[model samples]
Target: MEEIWFAINDIPMDVLSRLPVKTLLGLKCVSKDWHRLISERSFIRHQLKRAEPVSGFFFQERFQWCDDDIKAISYIPVKMEGSEVQHSVFNFLPESVVLSAVSNGLICCRSCFPSPQPVIYVCNPLNKEWVTFPWSTPDKRSSLGLAFDPFKDPIDKSTDFKVVTIHQTASDMEVEDEDKDSYLTFDIYSSKTRTWHRSREMCHCHHSLFKNKGIFVGGALYWLTDGDQILMFDVQNELSWLVTVPIPLVQFDSIPEMCIGESEGKLHYVLISEGGLHVWVLEDYLDFTWELKYSISLDEMEKENTEFLCNIQQRVESRMAVDTTPWMDPLAFKDSLLFMRVAARIYLFNFETRKLEELCTLSMLGPNSIISPIVLPYSMSLIPLG
Candidate 1:
């Protein structure tokens, strides 16, 4: 029987990698040899490279507290069930763990309570597997980012990942005049080496960490700065540098929100304004040149005659001149679907047709249970942990 299963599992590596991650996970119980083979790092990498489209969106639905918003802050996955129905998976993630970013199929999460600084973890929700970073003193002072290669090996369950931490002076630490602005260091953790190393003092140490999450595209981690500059960390070479993001057309007051992202296997920037959401691709990384690719008109979205968010114009009008404040941070962009959040409501916008439709309403989760939900891009992969 074991020999029969072995014969069934033995196949061309590339051919096996082409199979869906769910199919591969199902094959693991067929035999011990199959389990070992399916768990190979190279195999996982290959599978991720050929993995299918994103399976769902992972967002946190927070519940209000009696005092100062206890914020039952939770990580939840609202998975797509066919075209219209969505199912949520909660309690699978660690409690009070704030997920900051997702790369490939793994999400980067940090501890939110009990400690002044958070402990970081890289997790795979599909398999309920996670790996925690070794606690270090510097982790208390820095913001962390996760970067991985999802395209080359999205299928394999064992692709190595890197975590980059930017440490500034600890808020609680008493600082002398000399120590002020003297504490810029980056702590990098390599899964391959299973170790952490610190870099020399970075130039821009005093600037506070950006409130927005970091995006990893083309093997580099990107973070926005208050001074309109971007911090780029090369994951492959483990080097840090600053780059000026291409300036967008001034469309509104308060400087319309924008962020860097990855689309179609290339690095791109997304600008959200009253005019529309403009996409600019970084054509030349060497010269820092950009090319405007697509400009989506928000006005067209208001014209769609759909039941979902049909009265968005009315909702926007009630907020005086400020209008509505979207949750910011798009979940994922693919095949014309732009997933984003407006407060507690998640919507799917089609850039081609300019049709905006609500995907899911957190009010269904319970009244006021959806405090400060964050939209995160989710790609299901066959990731396994030992």
Candidate 2:
């Protein structure tokens, strides 16, 4: 290995950055010099730029019928055409933990319900390095968000990463009635300081924020509410506010199925309605201007993959109530690729080619359970949290 490193020591960084993350990781062990070069923040960023838009995804199936909320997390590689879901990839974490939020290549996993004290673990599955955050008291009805920017100044001693927890205020939680008024509040945990600070800001909304993972875009974290608004929290300023969703409540007779994502540092919203999947991008963040980028016809997709979808539908119907589940659910969007679920199978939709290809099938659920897999778009990175 020493001789090999000496022979290739003069290789340009541009060429080395183009190498796969796994290859770069192996090269780090060649010599201390190679390790230092690979560990530089600039090299990490350049390598990420050369990496695929999205290398793969991590998804966790939430059993709607189970109260424990303990589920197995699986990974599906995008380049692997016939890859089986890797179930043991996250075996380093506790089995009772469920995926809550993911940013960059780091994922946040929270302990299951019915615990005296709840805990959250933020880690990079690629390196298997993690940090734990245990609460002294139980936090009821909260949504966790992770905010990490690789471009942040390395010299800044304030924060390397942050975890924002949004929840109902103590007084608001005391109110048992769902129709009563309540206040939304949040607390942020800083990785650099290894401490949490509560925010003074609060807002009133019709219902609680969806427990789904928060979406990180730009420098803020966003969580969708039960109503047609999203709660946005600024990481640096430590302020929170609400932004109206693109699809107003007045426009739709009933709520439409939609999900939020980020691509190229801009927010993108995907909604499924009218026998098609509509994509809207926030072109102007300040003015809140949205532009319709793509409208894909699900009918055409169904026609092309009739046999495959039929087989998936048969398996889905045997386990879940077909009427309750959305026919086509958008899972994650990144770059030009959109990961969605038609029946129990996940597919990759490329905007450049306007084609959809099957990626993997979700795991089977118990006879009494319904599966609703939460998929997070992931790109491999070797950045360390500590």
- For TM-score, the strongest prediction is 2
What stretches of model 1 exceed 4 Å from their correct place?
1-16, 23-43, 61-96, 116-118, 138-141, 150-159, 169-184, 205-212, 248-251, 304-306, 309-337, 350-355, 364-373
In candidate 1, clashing pairs total 9
Model 2, 226-343: lDDT tens digits are 6777777888888777777776744543334667788778778777654356778877655667888887665665566565555333332233332466556667777767887776
Q: Please report, as a residue range, the 10-residue window in candidate 1 with the lowest summed lDDT.
A: 67-76
Q: List the residue pairs that clash in candidate 1.
A: 44-156, 45-153, 47-154, 47-155, 48-153, 48-154, 48-155, 49-151, 49-154
Candidate models: Cα lDDT each? 0.61, 0.70
What CA RMSD would candidate 2 show?
A: 4.5
The superposed Cα distance between candidate 1 and the true structure at residue 340, in angstroms, equals 1.2
Q: Relative to the unseen true structure, what is the C-alpha lDDT of residue 4 in candidate 1, on a scale of 0 to 100?
A: 63
- How high a TM-score does candidate 2 get? 0.83
Query: What is the TM-score of each predicted model, taking all chains together?
Result: 0.74, 0.83
Q: How much is 169 displaced in model 1, in angstroms?
A: 4.4
Tens-digit lDDT track for model 1 on 1-386? 75465366545566778887778889889778768877787777667667366555655543344322232433323343445433334345555566667787788877764556556778887788888776465343356788877554343445578888776654445665545654446777877778888765364444454534567877887765544556777767766666666773333443355655666767666666655577777776667788887785554554563555344433433433323344343445543456665667766666667766666666644465334344566767766654
